[model samples]
Target: MIRIGIVYMATGYYCRFWKEFYISCETFFCIDAEKGYEVFTDSIELLKMNIPNVSFHAIKDKGWIINVSSKSDFICSISERLRQNYDYIYYLNGNFRCLKSIYSTEILPEEQNGYFAALSFQHNRYKSPNEYHYDRNKNSHAYIPFGKGKRYYQASFYGGRTDELLKFSEWSRNMINKDISNGIIARYQDESYLNCYLQDSEPLVLSDAYGYSDFTHYQGEYKAELINKNQYLGTSLLHARSLLPVSQVKLQGNLGDQMFGFAFYCYLKKFWRDGQRKTILSLLPEGRRTTDSLYGVFPIDITDDIKIVEQQCKNLPEKKIIKVTEKFSSVFYQVEDFNAPVVVFDGKWQCYQYAEACEDELRESFQFSLTHLSEQSKEILNKIRSCKCSVSVHVPANTADSYNILLQKIISDNYFERAMEQMRISLQCEPIFFFFRDECPVEELWEELFLISQCKHHIITNNSFSWWGAWLGKNTEKLVIAPKNWSFWKDTPDLLPTEWIKLPINIDKKQLNNIIGQQILKSQVTENIGLYNGKMGYVLFFFHCARFLNNIWYEEYAEELLSEIYEGIHWDLSISFSSGLCGIGWGIEYLVHHGFVAGCTDDILSELDKKVMEIDIRRIEDKSLEHGLKGITCYVSSRISSPRDIVSTLPFDPSYLNELKEACLRLNIKMTQLTSINDILKGIKTYYMKLHKGAPLWCELYCVIDKIEKM
Candidate 1:
């Protein structure tokens, strides 16, 4: 027996709309994650009404979201249902439409049994190597137009042996595990993976004109050829947007949840204007008009002003009948055959109405903002004197799709600031209040004028800390905002309904600031390399030994002091050893590769001299200093890869210090003559200490300082 299931999370508009469609299936089931008392009772009642020959099962578990992982305990229950001698199983997720019956003359009966047959519409940018391609233009882009004046739909189907499918399932689980570990899924990647296995099966590819019963509302002139079949032998796959014509049932109550209810009614009204009859075939009680169809019952009421709806029937040779019922609430239609010549009425409601509804919801959810009358910003200047300016900022925290949208919005907003100014003027306001969702750090947002505007003037943000800082001044009011269309926060408090300054939903911002801010904040919270106990212990041990070695005179033990200096400094020996392996030539190669100097001639010397001055390598002399004037000199310098390239080793710049003293005499360096001498002596002392460890000793300095008496 073929067992098919229509899985739904909860009762909503789509559920009620597809009631008859699900009932027509061989086997039907509903999976409710929440299992709320009201939803459970209603679902059980609905199941009992349709469950004579059909086997129905419901699992009340909160594992729907955990389906992405290869191992889902929920799948186990589903697998159990499949093992009960089900020859075929078709799983249809909610919010889907059945456009056409799966039976077609083009496919053979043998190919239709034992496996799954799914339909996919190709609009994705990422296409696989083996997928069919046709050329429109010479550009090799995915989903570009193929061939002349005609396009073909390419898809992979999976429907074969049950054992092979079970094997594919195991493989799919493994691939899911690998994908999770590597983080390699790029949108619809699971579908892509499924396509890979199905590719070898050489599945059927529909022409653009083929009849498909899947989702997203199939249109055009070819839909009639696929429907009105006596029986469907194969399963039809669809996207999540399909809606069907339900002539049998007249829907009432909150029509918001029904799939394309109002929108379909509008289309029916238009069809009625085109002289089409309203048909209903169900006698559902409590409504004005009763009607009946092939399977269920319905009632109708005509509400729109387009035309006075009239019920009609076209009796066919096969005893098929079309019934229409009309009243004040809604119109109902029903046909006798299981496969009726139904008009495709998908995608309900006007876009503007949807947008306005979202706007109103947003307004109710957020607070209002005050605009300064004198602000110079064009975006701010166009608001009415008393009217509030509302702007919403979006920050997609973890979702990549949201991130991409956010980046685009940020770029567009920055580009359109001038237009925003003109728009503000057009709106007749002195100042416009802008709202932002700040996800980025304030420190990294130097280039973001949006955030700067809030800091300097009248603006509000969802970033609570920054919002308070912006609203600190005593003279102005603040605004907070939230999204209008989405009420489920998905565990994010940032999206919750709270008192915030309201802003118009500007999807253009995309919430990039949130990402930048989080990154900056993360960096701030996680920085401390040498603070580890082991590292600190090593540092203290090295410091004590270095202090002990300073007591030795350099002239008496220059080689030993060099070793001590090497031991004293914590050299990152990994790089040092790597450098050592590459040898002296590697150091010169690095300098040359970096464009530091050219040629073998004294170019390197000149650059080194310039760097020496830039780094402030200096001289010093003082008896009170730890290392007194000795047979050693020191100079401050950065690391050099090779010792072979370095020629001169100088400590204190005695000549530069003497020159500075004379320059100070000429009213130059802000020091008394005696203080200048002391400064030079301090510099000499520093140079002497450094010479004990860092710099190569100058032979002349050792000779001169070594010749001096201890006095």
Candidate 2:
């Protein structure tokens, strides 16, 4: 019997691919070292455990293993196989897998009478000539002397008789060493050396079936078909190189970072190509007169919202204008007529400095009415209105150090508590308070402002959004409390109304309390909380809760609210919801459930579908889905004291639960019910089991559950 040895080394993400390959090979043939199918690797211990059927040999020689270049691994593996006196040795990349069984005699070079056996490279998928592989001007040792029309071979997979393979490895090593000595490494490095050596040796040629293209250029299913078709053609091995499907490969460390960077670059390139190309004319009146289109490069960072800027520009009339930018500096509200002598607004916060200047205009231009509230929003609003007084709080947790320090100072000075205490004393009743944290979206910020504008009083920080909210308030007798020092620099009195209270940044809590107590005793405050009764309010509240709690249920509820709102108006809500949920974590699930629920509109069935879809069927680490379920169960449990009340209100029919199971099976999500707090706790545990230890979401969910258990 002819002895065959396959040698490979996998260090990182390649380990995952290697496991698949080893399993596939074992399925086809008996991969035993004593039985001639010997495996060699640096990580023998890992391979031994993962592939128990295969006998592994550890490569102990440090001199032969080169970390900088993969080509060195190829040379080392071949050398080790030669020393072991194997009849035939195959040097395959860790990513190569055997799709079918093959005898050693079939791959051995009989007619060619040469050592190495490799398949000729296939046609380039990108429609470029093969000559693109080499630089003709470079005089490197590994540079192959290319003929006009000769086909090249991939060095990813190759096999040969022991002696011939040794000779080939030595030749490659010498060529690589020579190139290194001359300070000239070939572009393809080791593959270049192999090709150069092959030019002189003229080794046995296998069919293209042995080494087919499996890169991103090729479709996944089609590539899989091609790989399987090779098995039918009596070809055993298929080389995938490093281009394994993302679903199959679990990337780690620098490889994952590099892939993310590459993906980001691709995303940026696509964004640039598809981005709006309109030019904003920032013309100065005294500047040189020219008809030429002024081209200024706007450098965009990752944080910049290109879509928002594009949307803002859409409102302006399409024209170039010259204006004195210094006189009318704020372009956000003034750029109504682009052709007129007005400031040209590029989508930036600096432009929004004068957003307050045209508050009435902005309000009229945009839809901010509360005439169509959803059922859920109506409920939440009623809860908010139950209190005697309402106060909106804005805390910038994710802002710059200056703002964060300001927030810390306010917290330390007991500003928030003092304000709440004053409101309670002043109203002589329980106050309803809303906290706007850092992660709140811009749209939600506006909604919060709209809601706050309807409140009896407002306690805000040095935030522009809060300022806009206070300014937009319908309450003429509204008590607006703000920080004395609005910024790191001196306060700008013009930014706030003279009637507003400007308290010191670091106010003495005892002194302020006494002053606020006296003011409350003297003043006659008689304003009630306003309730939102519009679909917009409901939609806004749903999204706000979704983001704040990081829950998918609220997101889905928001989508459902939009669906209802659109159906009411006879408008297509799918288009708007699709665009809005594009980058959102639970977008895909929401869309899937939306379509499924829309098709099956029975209330009971829809509720079951929602619950089924809410479970992370993807089996991926989706924090949104986890937190969403947690938040939903938490909210439900808190609102309804009795489990029977929850079941009756959000009833889950037994028949529908079975249907939910079937739906979850189809969607691949593991469905669980929140029949009670116990069920929610069980789900938390199940999710915790799936999550890795010390993962941020894992810790967060653990803490949340732990708090609930205590409660």
Candidate 3:
């Protein structure tokens, strides 16, 4: 017959859950005194009401402490009882209820096993220091530790075989009694002392079912438990912990917090004594760790209504079991072939933490190291860098602080004048300047870059998003520069193999104090800003568009022109009108009126459709009418699609397209979503004939003005 014992503190709160736990186990005896009779009676009543296998011993006036402090009393309680009668002993706490049922048929023969069993569970939610385990990877389970970064292999101890297990239990009892008599108690009481002293004592690392417990309140640690001792050796199909009986949970009033705390304490101690920590790598047969052997209990099946208990079994890990010390009442097994997943050492072994003495051999034998890159990552980075690009600059369109104010400031003329002066000094070799950020006063920034620096400025961005701005740029041949690595999520993996120069730096300090240094550089320099302006200077613009830069002003035609320029020069553009627009002259109505040649703007299509006199007919039977319409198209297209046009800086929300399209339909002016500059240029070619005949002189003069504007 298999014997199981539950040693509870008999605290008032754990009475109910304990009752449920008692009813779930088979041939189990409770170890609380008669004063704990209320809790004990509750268990007996629960057993009679539901489960019928387990029994309880209401010991009067016996205080058995099980913590980091009290080891001897715990050992004596078991040693004294096991010597009398009992084939197997399962230690359970007061607070936990069985999620499964244990039966006598599950016990393994004593001849086939040595001593321990461990159950694994689901690890953690995040990289929480208190819960995460380092070795827990894609294929393995995670275990939480006691203090910080400490973890223990969870198990439920079943002192199997009265003849063999009792011998160790007696010895464990004697040692504790001796310590008590001598008044010798270590800081870490029974569990800690037993755990520390049991180092070379018992045969450790036996495989079993997965057990779980809430260790935060009681021992202040999280752990797993073991239940199926007989099934640890070989039976793969039977790898499961018996479920606890739900009928055993007493549905009474609230079972106060203390009972919950103590009940969990009991569960923790039961596993601490019986379950041994072994790495998942060693437990697998032929080096294979599968989720099949592991099982979840506490959080899964345990509710306010269920009673859980352990199932006894004989299958154990195939390894040599060495008995360390023959002094404890509960004998621990030392398995030579396995290693503890985590080992807690007395301050003496500080440097050699996380790893055991034999870890070096394990690493050398397995040949494992951290892996960083994949083939896909290498391919993507290379593609982005190898493209020929004229522009590469970060845009500041994100609403970091005061997005409205920054947009206003960016569009201001004074800011552009100052920014232009800086750019004039900075651009020595690179002829093209790239711009990216939130939608800003693009015309103002463009005018300044063109007029002040006398160099072509290019804007590289996908919509108004700042992240898209930086990412869309494919100017690997051009100097790639940005404010800095501003995002915490962004990592500078050696992903981009090419070395692109970072431009946010001060160049003034490098100017030599003597004329000889200047003379040598001046003779070799073909182009210099000082040659025109006669001033030694440069500009370093920070890429962030936060609230601090809100003092700037918006230029008049900035938004209207920017939108047109974007449509003309780029392959993709989405036109939309909105009533709830903010900052500068950014209303949807104003943009639509300025952008009417491209698309119409209105809340309802009925309103704009009524206003449409006629579509600008590309071919009319009368040459004069056809010629007049073509001229208008040419003029509108050229001005709107000019590369210097300014547009709004608001970030593009991907979902805003439908409403924008609806607004365009209101005026019967269908908007064209251009994918590239080539499309708009093709549209320009269609209107070339009318432009030559209807307004030939003005169109020719306008083209000259466009050329002079750049100069």
Candidate 4:
């Protein structure tokens, strides 16, 4: 029998994948070979439960613990033993699974000029030379100049005769050590090291199918598959402890497109234990100047993240760009695969959970303050508040060029007629309707949208602007009716909330009634006990949700839940981007500086000011973004790392920010209400350096900004 040794490092979060890999290997791998499994893991107790043909190395030695702290370190430690013991040695990733019976002939190195040698599988994502993700940082040992690498080899699957593989392992350890001593990690970590070695030594470059990944859209059969295990384990703790990936995401498309992309980016951050604050590369079309579009619309500070690498996006020399797009309104890339270190996001990524994952941030970014509403708008809001039920119904005027008019016609008059009948029955009461006229004045945009957001419910012609209103609305149990199959080209994705009732264009009133759900059938009549703003707004929120979602049945048990909010002022309450606040007048600084309209009345701001003024922010003790004064201020401070626009800073004067800063003196926070391009660059570089220290490697990318003024 041909003796074979397969090493698997199943330490940390990867521990769960061990048995699956072992079983698949035993069942499908070369049956003729005498296979010996060498397991390197920290989970000895969990892995030792009735397994066979495997020797578990505890991985407890101080030498192993303090070394490279990567899979390569564990494999290198056993290279010598395996070399002396087995005829051939292979190091397989824990996530890799064997699918078909494979003889040693398929994987084992063949005689190359009378000597058995090493072999590696080509990376599935990068194929051509330019697309190869070779380290380009000229400062590192693994650095391969722009166009030198022959083939990009994935480090996940590779093996050879023990003597040859041991030599390869030692070479990798030396290169990694050198890179570490110089404080520069090769791009993609050990993968770059492997690619660097494979470039010169012409190993048998197998096809990409040998090491296929689940995310790869290719439908071809493969030997081993790379699958996700997050569904089976607690990823938060494991991912947090593992080596930080040198991954960077580059978003592509327009402002609206990026809004969805950024949300997905935020989702990736949460999934990988990396917050969305890290500067991501924003790749736009050539000649498009990167604009500070987040401005007041997003809950982001310019100084916080250094995203966008392309200096004007002119020199298009980026090695690899794995573009992700939607196919028939379906997600092109799995949400889980998005967490990988390097990927390009393009087109519309309307994954429902993408928004839900970062819903708090999204809400906070779009917050609109009471004072920010104009006098006319405030009146409209008051009316919305007074109504027992307010439902926004968006409709565009006849315009030949616009898509909305076309879609509106597609839904036709019958859709609205049915919607009206459905609304009446669902609410079980008369409900007011709001519209979105195509010719509405630009100046009235904020007021119009603010009025829409205040509404208890929404019905719409396909419109992104109005869709945002429903997204930012306050009612947890509110009704949102959208025309199903609104587009002509493809089946529309669930861009709206799943609970939001969807009616086919020609559906009968009876069909609509059936789809509206039982919860909506019951809760149309609100008591209107209090206005939906300020502290009292919270009570109404629970009351609203309690009627439909019985999760909070003990709603009446609270003792003075309103005590914490700024004295009994009416505030619009909704889910917000961050935890701090979502009421009309809440998170004032964040709302004003980020995106929410700050057009509030003096009474509202004055009352909120009193709450912060009364407390010594540091002494508040609650180190949370919601309750503590210090926490609230810190949350606001953390957002404005380096913003480049001042228009959103309007109405909420500099004096207001000063008062906030004065309230939290010496609290290690920066609330600079104004930011310059220089400030933006400096902040971005500072952020990059921090990542360089901890994560070390960065993909070569460029952020294109065409609209911003160059300093």
Candidate 5:
């Protein structure tokens, strides 16, 4: 006779699911085999009860989250005894009920060239490769890149022979502990690790019928199904902890900010109640209709038309509300537990911890819409991808006006320059540096960020835009360097991921002397912004460190830069975009945007628009976005809602396009710069479609994962 062992854990309140599970296993699980039940739990009374072949071992409760991740390790500790006594061993989910007989052959793996492990099917079987919530945190041992895997397996029910199962358990246990040490709990925790293991493990893929749950609404021949926990635990969180049946999430902030709330939604849905659906309380961004595919966690009900949340609350019985703002931003261990039947999270919710909890989902949903890029940007992207070694250095001058100026002290131009130089020296190949200058020569904002993310490594400021771009980057060996000091109180909040290197800003000798008014200062801020001194290297040092000098220094410098620019605008004679007066005047707008000087560069840039009329549009062959006629025209016309569909980045004046049209009309060329951009985007989509299949990154800004199945 074949010997079979059922390894199970039913600690604390989980014992409530034990009675039904025990009866089902004894009656319907491997009837012909000689069976023994190995139970691990905290209930001492279970040992005294004569429950057939069941033998209970007293186990200290480690909580659900810890227990779920370490379940494999627990079995591994007893693997020697299990393998000796039984011909086959399987660990079934504690909450699932075996409704009919499941034979040993159905659950066991057969040898196929090498040892094979058995894997279970996710409730919802079919999903696009990008739709699967693969752990995106490069720091986590569970991370699986976007295109690496095709199957999304459910961890609730899976098992194999004792020897092969031990191999998987040992590997999984080590990865889980490492994640805990790094303070990372991957998306769906244990399940995320299982998917990571199954990515390359061409294991025997079991049918969805074995792990079926009524909540999935997936009709199939069911041998076993996950029973609802609410029937036993009621509304108490002692069983689930940190997860409660949520009624609705109250959303706040602009569209980009509100996207942070989805992570909280993931936690709330962990232990859901019947008739409960993921619901949001705020109005969505204008164009994102319910019909369209959202970033991730799509098909959720939007109670937008109702303005008053209290009025909206009247529909549901729960009156209590929990708001998660910067006040609660210190959350890193886990989302705070809610005791109420209906949990509500309201506020800016700028916490990265929430994003980390559901990082795979966030990466899928908020995948950057790359189709918004220009043809020139796509060419640069191909070059970045073709090169094995590349690094992006992002130093934001725009944030100086908005954030507290004291925050600027934490980073400097010298910090960026040295970081780039060190990367070049350390890497085997000469690294191509893509430096994000103070004034972006490129017109589109998302294109600039999309380009930065494609690079293999990154150096980011305290800004959120770059923080997201760096986090979304899929490079396996990617290195991200960020400034240690961020806030005025000197507290380094849980903003940057722990895996990223945090270094203090190192000011160079020239920049250091510029600050503290030392005698060794290389050049005056006034002289650095001269008409001729605006060369790349000189401008890199001056514009980057300019914020180090007082606001008055930039105010005087920008004023002087534009005062001389008016004289050069008409007589400079050069018609080229990058080398001409047009480039100098274009860069000054950044100084104005940074709050250095107000309204100083507008008239000079406006007058330079007339200078484009003198050049022949047909003769100029350069079509690159950086220094081409297309780039210049887009800059002059102001990049208004190109393909990003978001509001304009530069805040262009209404008459800007009309002014450009007049210039183009004088030369008899149709004002077709926007049409040219759209044409280029079509060609780029053809290329991405070939690479990503039907799911091209450029089709729409968002990937439509309208999967509404109960995950």
Candidate 6:
């Protein structure tokens, strides 16, 4: 008979999320009658009451240090204590919910002395091998080994044979003790030590299927299967303690000892009350609008109109407003319960309503000014002001040709001429056409709006910016001309005011030149504003003490040497050590075989240097060549075998490397193929001196040279 035990701990606030985990686990175990399951926790009485059939073991507080470090120690101790009774022991974190029954057969191997662990989904933070550092002086609980690339296992769900687990626990405990004695802690408490231990141990690695955290949002094959079949699976962290804000969790008025319930209640009450009283206007910007495809409209900046809307709201006595600035979808999940009446101000509101709302105070607030203007800009402004009327034209470049044709029809309908004629008759000023084009400075554009506002008459486009500018203009007798159709798909009746003249969409193009008399010259005031594929070099430093030694002095020396070589030259430098586990060997082999200068061969280095010089000289003659030139160099330190073996060392499938090779060949890019420690004092000194001088010292030059010569 197989004996399996699931152990967890719940001390303080851990109980809140633990409830779900506990219930889920109990439900799963109850369905499987053949499996003998036992749960061990500090809250045994509570568990026994909640889950009647399951056996509960109460862990008495033995006055052990209660920190992240102590938590691991406690887990190890429990595993050790239960080793004799259970053949297979599984330790699950209190926050981990078992949605389905994970049979021992499914997870554990049939044979004994087998260890199992799952890779962490939170690979960016804890699993980054490059970022692993443990200093004795620092009071932290996380450690990452030097020069190791990110490959980590989550300690939340790890189990093995009773004897193997006990031994693993003991070894981890010893490491912790050593760290504690030296007044230091591992980077991630138990998780760090577990990773350190596993680096030297062979464990059965499980995919993210077994240990799915909240961060793993993508429903992979396993997760999809669980969902499709309506089966329950494991979920690691339902609620992350670090992410939850303290104020959000703090209890206000508690009905009982339940803090989470009380806090949630208080949160809902406060936000709901505030939401109920306010007239919530959700202004979805063009980027935020989800119905853009349905409407067949181009994106427009509604920032100015938003201000107008806010000003209009302020004028109304009963408009108790709460403006939600972001997209509705993003914030809806957070405050879904706060049921407020939402009004999306999509630029189809009545113009007179806005015009009447724009009081003296509103107009003053909407007025724009430029603190400084260039001479060319000043001259352009003068020319625009000299015109009897200013026109704002909207061309639908991003939309279909049909939309542009409609715009062209409006432009050719003698609209600008008629508007100018009207302005000349009324305001007795000559109208000058002004429109914003690409590369127009923002300040100058705002100034154009200000200039348009000053105009006695305006020819407006089917744009929110133009509408707002015309509305905000100081002219009392302004002739606001707008297109009949705001969009081809929809008729915008409320877009134009009764006072503003609406031009027909299909106006005659021949009648256009008659009213204007002369051709309106297009604005001549123009504003103009405006690592791969090259000779590469690789420096390989083969130092025997590269992996084992944590001496800061060597690191500092390496960094200095790298900086010196990298400062003046446009070389893309990478400093790596002779570490097999870090995949440096694989990187070097790929580089060397692909015709990249390894710096080991004098002939190759000289040729590369000559190419670099030639490129520099060519760049002086043709600036266009310099545009394509980029840094393409690297510093490699590892012993590499043949290209085939190097490619095999990658964690991924061998086919991926083949695809990579194919891609490199297609792109005409070279891959360089570039090891292990010897504690020779003379070799070490020589390597250090060579590194300090920024000189490449190849220990195994023949290996790469021989491979390259054959190629």
Q: Candidate 3 on 50-100: residue-level lDDT in tens?
A: 433333434322111322122223435556555454545444434334444
- How big is the RMSD of model 2? 23.4
Tens digits of per-residue lDDT for model 6 on 40-109?
A: 4456445556554355556543111223345545656556457656776666765566566655566674
Alpha carbon lDDT of residue 286, candidate 3? 25
TM-score of each model, in listed order: 0.24, 0.29, 0.22, 0.37, 0.37, 0.28
What is the descending lDDT order? 5, 4, 2, 6, 1, 3
Better of 3 and 4 by TM-score: 4
Worst window of 10 by summed lDDT in candidate 3: 537-546
RMSD of each: 31.3, 23.4, 25.9, 25.4, 22.9, 29.3
Query: TM-score of predicted model 6?
Result: 0.28
lDDT of 1 by residue, 1-711 (tens): 233232333332223433544442222121211110111112554546554434444533212121223222233335554444344333333323334444433322245432445444433223543243432222211112332222223222222233334455566555655444432221232344455455445444433233344442555533212232122211121111111212333433222212123333433333333112232222222534321110111122343211211211222222222333331122223222223323222221222222222443322322223332124443433442334443323332332333223334433454234334534554444445444443344322211222333432333222322332232222234333322322111112222224432333233323423433333343233322121111211222222222333422222232332233234333232111111111112223333343332344234334333333332212323222122211111111112222335564332255654543443344323322221112323343345445553211121121112222111
| Model 5 alpha-carbon miss at residue 397, Å | 29
Off by over 4 Å in 3: 1-9, 26-85, 101-156, 180-184, 196-198, 201-208, 214-711
Please report, in order, the local distance difference test score of every candidate based on alpha carbons.
Answer: 0.30, 0.43, 0.28, 0.54, 0.57, 0.41
For residue 141, give model 4's deviation from the true position in Å.
29
Pairwise lDDT winner, candidates 3 and 6: 6
On residues 1-711, what C-alpha lDDT tens digit does candidate 4 reach at each position?
A: 888988777666667687788889898887679898888777858556555668787764212122223556667777677877798877776678888787887777666611223334434335767667788878877888876877677766777877777777788877776666443556677778777777766666655456666555657777767775544554444333332322344544434445666676666655644221122435344523333233334444432123223221223223323445555463434544333323454556655667877899777766554555577676777888999888887665675433333334334588878887789899977998866564555445555666777899888665555566677688988898886654433345657678988876652333322322222322223322221212233332333233333434424411133333434334342222122232223333333343322344333455444443344443444432333443445433433432435654432345655666665565544454322222322233344444453110100000101111111
Q: Who wins the lDDT comparison?
A: 5
Error of 3 at 31 (Å): 22
TM-score, cand. 3 vs. native = 0.22
